[model samples]
Target: MGANAAAFASLLRGATNLSQCRWILEQLINSRYAGDIFLGNLALQMFGKLHGIGDARALFHRMAQTGRNLFSWSIMISALCRDGHHREALGCYHAMNLEGGIEADMVILSTVIGVCSALQNLCEGRKLHDRVAGCGLESDTVVHNALVSMYVKCGCLDDARAVFDATPTREKDAVSWNVMMAAYSSRGKFQQALEIFNDCLLHSVQGPDAVSFVTAISACCGLKDVKQARALEELSCSHGFLETSVAVQNSLINLYGKCASLSEARLVFDRIASKTALSVRAAVMEVMLRREEKFCHRFVIAFMLPSILMWCLGLVF
Candidate 1:
């Protein structure tokens, strides 16, 4: 690639506007590098970001008419997956495998695993897991993470935990811990989630990120353990998680309300810098309804008029 082609490719990569992307794509097509596979893949990526799925599919088919490389197949498959066309993405993945020349790599496997996770297709997920092992890519942390996540989504917690246990400690990141906690929490296994979360805190390899705290706190909410929830609130606040993450604050509010600690819930609500996205208002109403039943009506009239309006407008419960 020349300076001009390189610059154009960079432009495509950075482009956020669909119109500009189309114009730049047209320029590339009329230029000397029109037949370049890299440039074609770049166009496909730009189209994918634009959510122009039809255009992206057309581009992929056009590219395949001449030939399709591994990157080309991966891009198309990933684009389809991003566009919420999992069936097509799976079809493309299988088709790529049948194409005979190109072999699926870790990147492709990761993307396909995500598709399986989204679709919750355990059978296909197992096949892909086997393929990852057979290709000797099972040691890859990212691919292993994807495989674990897929099994978790498929409701195979045992399989997910097996993979989690087998993965080297160095290979396990915050995502690995979060996935296991989420799997347990989703299945109403809050005790297991909290245990994994404690282990996460103890090991501190990748350290606990916002999702880690939020997931564990959510598990605490499910269990309604006021003491543990309060401790998590302290940990989250001490870590500056509350300052940076609205989701953490929201989770804290919900946790407090669930634990019948209405004062702490109100404190969290008040501490939130921006309350636009939180469900704290509902948490307030819930606390009032459950714990302050005698004053619930008066509280709604005095302090929850916005919530009343939201209810009238069908925007809230």
Candidate 2:
């Protein structure tokens, strides 16, 4: 029976679609292994992955009747969040707390804090923050990052910065720097955003990724500092992001356009093999609105007419 349960568990892991999962689950039930905690957790995860939330909830209730474990509760809460049921996800966490015996781990805490971030429930997020301290998980990097993100999304930059500063230097990852930079940029604190960017380059263990470059370029665009924008362009190029990431390329085009560097903007736009409508619009709008020279307007119109038509035809999305 143990060998059969292991084979069924393996099959559950490999199941791709809802149909396969349901069939395997039926097999487990017939084999009298459906109530097994480990197999039940696997089924719960598969149902969640396949968007079978209703099935997941049903299975969760059955597991609860027989006594659900931490993994069971965590899977259900995460599934609820993924399906955009943030309120329900919080409710699940609360129910887990009421049931006792299961200590909240980093995975569950991070997920529930993210639910608060999504809902912008600052009050609940604070409660969770207190809970993190109570459970002695404040030093966990994953939970700390989630707390920072929650505070940022809630429009509490001071709180976010406090958590960010408290995060151990070696534990800080790309997400930590990117979220802080983006928060400052979104709030029009462009200088602060750039400061965070510079710090990330100096201190982050894994260094910056595409998002860091985009956010920093956006801050330069806000300041209209052409020299800084050019420096970032060069840095992005050195990082090989300019040629690889469409988001970084698009941000550069917009940055140069806003800085009134039409030639630089056009150069970046011309390099994109798969230009988005944003890139096309950014390039053409700058040319049409800024350049008073009739010949330049005509040249832009002629050069961009094909892409404009493609955009109109819904082909260049």
What TM-score against the true fold does each predicted structure earn? 0.83, 0.88
- Predicted candidate 2, C-alpha RMSD: 3.7
Per-residue lDDT tens digits for candidate 1, residues 14-69, read: 88888888888889878887778888988898898789888888888888774569
Model 1 clash pairs are none
lDDT of each: 0.84, 0.88
What is candidate 2's lDDT per residue for 98-144, written digit by digit as tens?
88888889899999999999999999999999999898887688898
Candidate 2 TM-score, C-alpha based: 0.88
10 residues in a row with least lDDT, candidate 1: 294-303
Off by over 4 Å in 2: 270-278, 292-317
